[model samples]
Target: MAFVGVERAVRQILQDDADVFALVGARVNPAKAEQGPATPYVVYQMIANEHHEMFGGSAGLANALIQISGFSTSKSEVLDLREKVRLALQGQTSVVTVGADTFDVRSIHLEGDRDIDDDPRDGSDAAIYGWAMDFRVGYPEPVP
Candidate 1:
């Protein structure tokens, strides 16, 4: 699926970055958080997809809204990770290969980002900071 292509491309780009890997250690996940990673980790999910119609009402393109979140005990560190994810995804226009299908990513637009604070799960006084970023990705339909 086109979403698969987009996810693969995003994961590949983020994992290839030395700074991101050093911080998160390959903690990128799809729609779920990793059970036991030190402090910082990343989780991504495809929230929505809207198919675009051509002049004759035939849909051949779509835009996917993907959410990538960074969680850490340090606010600054999580924000930095959010920035890294943004840089890796924004404005990408490459042809990504997923399985046996090739899809072209038209563009990646950062919709918005926010910071979250929550109490620790271990009943500690400290709070964990999470940074979430939403990216709107435009890509071609998967070849059938």
Candidate 2:
């Protein structure tokens, strides 16, 4: 499969994806970069993997990328999204606005990946593969 379209996939999900509010903090505090309009409030990303971005300093720039992030077509797809975020935050990237709502994402990074193993099927006495996910995201604020 082609990996080039991950950006579109991410953008599509961020805008059209349901369950957005649950992944975000209960309230918005613009004082926190990670909670402000600039940041990508991805509640689905958090829920899918049960992980959130690590924030430090003022801007909380994500230094690490989430492993097994649910957003990418492949492992490296998240990194491409990161570059898009970097460009957006630096005024180098655009067209990320979500719907008529005007939501945005920033300070992108990979949070981490989830590890999974095969499950033994008792019925057939066979092994079955399963899937797990990890979340990676960028914070809008600088690391404190």
Candidate 3:
């Protein structure tokens, strides 16, 4: 069987955490959250990926740069949520199963983070506060 993608594995990892679940439940989404998503949600996307090579041949390993963003009405809440995300993923190494596929995470590192405030693009007055976190994940390539 082929291995699971890092996005699926990361979502599973966040959902499996009690602290993160208590804060955002299953609101972790890919690229973006649901339309009008409730306060305190997380959105993640794979920003970059690099496959290693040795002797001009496949090295059977990869590094993925993923960005996880948390959004909420309250700035403090968004910050708290981002912190929970950090705790759940930083320095993590584990096996995650998404459906029948397995992902063996070799290492995870918190690369950077920042506060971001967004004006509603829909012309709504709701103030949206956000925090963006970047992580670099190392893992073996998926079996073909």
lDDT, candidate 2, at 71: 27
Query: What is the alpha-carbon lDDT for the whole of candidate 2?
Result: 0.31
Model 2 TM: 0.28
lDDT of each: 0.78, 0.31, 0.90
**Which parts of model 2 have CA positions greater than 4 angstroms off?**
1-97, 118-133, 139-144
Give the Å error, residue 22, model 3: 0.6
Off by over 4 Å in 1: 1-3, 55-57, 97-102
Looking at candidate 2, the ten consecutive residues that score lowest on lDDT are 27-36
* lDDT string, candidate 3, 1-144, tens digits: 875899899999999999999999989999988777777899999999999888868888999999999889888888788888999999999999888878999999999999887766457998999989999999998433
Choose 2 or 3, whichever is better by lDDT: 3
Task: Show how many residue pairs clash in every candidate, following the order shown.
Answer: 0, 27, 0
| lDDT tens per residue, model 1, 35-95 | 5456788888888989877677747788889988888888788888887878888887777
Candidate 2 root-mean-square deviation in Å: 14.4
Candidate achieving higher lDDT, 1 or 2: 1
| Deviation (Å) of 69 in candidate 2 | 6.3
User: Which rank order by lDDT, best down to worst?
Assistant: 3, 1, 2
Better of 2 and 3 by TM-score: 3
